[model samples]
Target: MENKDSKSEMIKSMAFRLFLDRGYDATTIRMLSRAAGVEAPSIYHYFGSKKGLFYAISESYLEDYQELLKESMKHWGADPMNQILGFVKFAVWYTMNHIDETKFYLRYRLFWPAELSEDMEKHFHKTNDQKEDLLRDAIRVCIETGSCKVDEQTAYRSLINFVDSCTFNIIFSNWRPDEQELIETWQLFYQSRIKLGKGDFEL
Candidate 1:
């Protein structure tokens, strides 16, 4: 018999593939148990329910992104604009590299299941709220340093709109732009929104 830790990992591996392949709503516990060669109760024992399992999968991705965000933010630059650009660059990198996870996470976030547990739902929202706060803090820093030409709110809105537009295109297109395309997009947005000079950033 598999030990508890190995069993949990086994279940999650199969569950991620199933969720990505069949989607959240269609994949049943019976199917998961069959795919993992485990009993249905084993899944409940490890994850509580389907939604809980999906949350575990999402947590894996979110935690990685959060760590990358924290580490990247620290080293991106001492300046606020660099941090903002770093944020966008990281999004592009993540979207390109983790396309499946990004799609699954975005689907779950955009169309949350009605049956999802309230705790899981709240945690997901809280995680995203913290990210938004982080971005807003960078924008606020630019306002304080007088580096940004616009108000903090406008800068934040513009940056978010740019990020969202880029994400939307990449996700819907099923792939991202090349590095130069992404860099040029960021440069254009930055000049239009924050920078007084139209010159591209050193990114």
Candidate 2:
């Protein structure tokens, strides 16, 4: 059973790398089998189809991301701004640490197989809604406490867009800011928007 689990994980890891490097449409079962040192039939036996393998990889990655987000939120204190900063720090650190998975998610997230796209969309929406709600609640607290000057909705949207774009550039583009540099840059921007006094909350 242990050997079987190891072999299955090996296949998934190899397939994930291939999909990251060569993309989903260009990757084939023969290539995956060769990379994983498994028979072609084993791929089908394990994953049923190429789409099944991709879905499994994507789901696993998203699950990891969700856990990281949840864990980050647990460390938040009374300050909503601190909570937001904590979330961003975890996000940036995760992207830098898991560049391959981040690249895979960015590249193939919207290009899933037709049969799976609708289901994937629903799953993604559900996951995103949870994150959105968390951010919205934090932003609301910031507004209520007079720490943030922007409206809750606008602040939430802007922060999400800014973080997503910055992280995407850090992963996919030539930008290679270190973890501290990324965190500090975001902290500066966020502090400028809010009414927080200097040294109130360290990023």
Candidate 3:
């Protein structure tokens, strides 16, 4: 017999897989229960309802990604270039390793969340701010070290937008060129747009 915690984990894992395979709308409780190898009521026992299961799945992604960001920050005393590269690699590995979770996050957390309550939306926004702040800190480090000359806030926002565009291409890699080529393109784009003033600019 599985422990309650084990049962809850099973429900969440099965629900996530089913969500990826069948989509959030198409995945039914019965189907999820069958995949979890438990009775339908058992799923309700653990998750309360289908909406509860969906919330668990959505929140799990945010929590896990936030944890990753926190962990990265713990070791981020390095240069901005290394920090950005490390983050890029981590993001790629994370997205590839947790494709289902990434898809759910992209769908519900990032893009479509019409059914989510305002509180839930605010929760995601707040949680996302943690990671965004970390990235900003990295850019600030660059500015302080004279490696970058852009305004901290504007540079951070631009970096995030650029990274998101790159990540979106990776997410849709089926239509994208090779990862190396994509990353190279991003490097050139960033270098040209984000000048490394190296203490030369007076303004």
Best by lDDT: 1
Candidate 3 clashing pairs, residues 3+ apart or interchain: none
lDDT of 2: 0.78
TM-score order, best first, reads 1, 2, 3
Candidate maximizing TM-score: 1
Q: What would the per-residue lDDT of candidate 2 be over residues 114-193, giving only the tens digit for each residue? A: 65667767757756887788789888988987878878776887678667877777776756677678777786767755
Error of 2 at 88 (Å): 1.1
Report the Cα lDDT for residue 10, model 3.
86
Q: How accurate is candidate 3 locally (lDDT)?
A: 0.71
For model 1, the stretches where C-alpha displacement exceeds 4 angstroms are 196-203
Task: Give the lDDT of residue 120 in candidate 2.
Answer: 68
Give the least accurate 10-residue stretch of model 2, judged by summed lDDT. 194-203
The C-alpha lDDT values of all candidates are 0.79, 0.78, 0.71
lDDT of 3 by residue, 1-203 (tens): 67999888888988888877777777888899899888999988877888788878777778888788768756755677667766765676676666667776776655543455564667678677776776777878888887667888767766676666656755786424456865676566556556652222110
**Candidate ranking (lDDT, best to worst):** 1, 2, 3
Which stretch of 10 consecutive residues in model 3 shows the poorest summed lDDT? Answer: 194-203
Predicted candidate 1 versus true structure: per-residue lDDT over 81-162, tens digit per residue: 7777888888888777877888777777777666774565676876688668878888888878877888877777777777
In the predicted model 1, the residue pairs found to clash are none
TM-scores for candidates 1 onward, in order? 0.85, 0.82, 0.76
Q: Cα RMSDs of all predictions?
A: 3.7, 4.5, 5.2
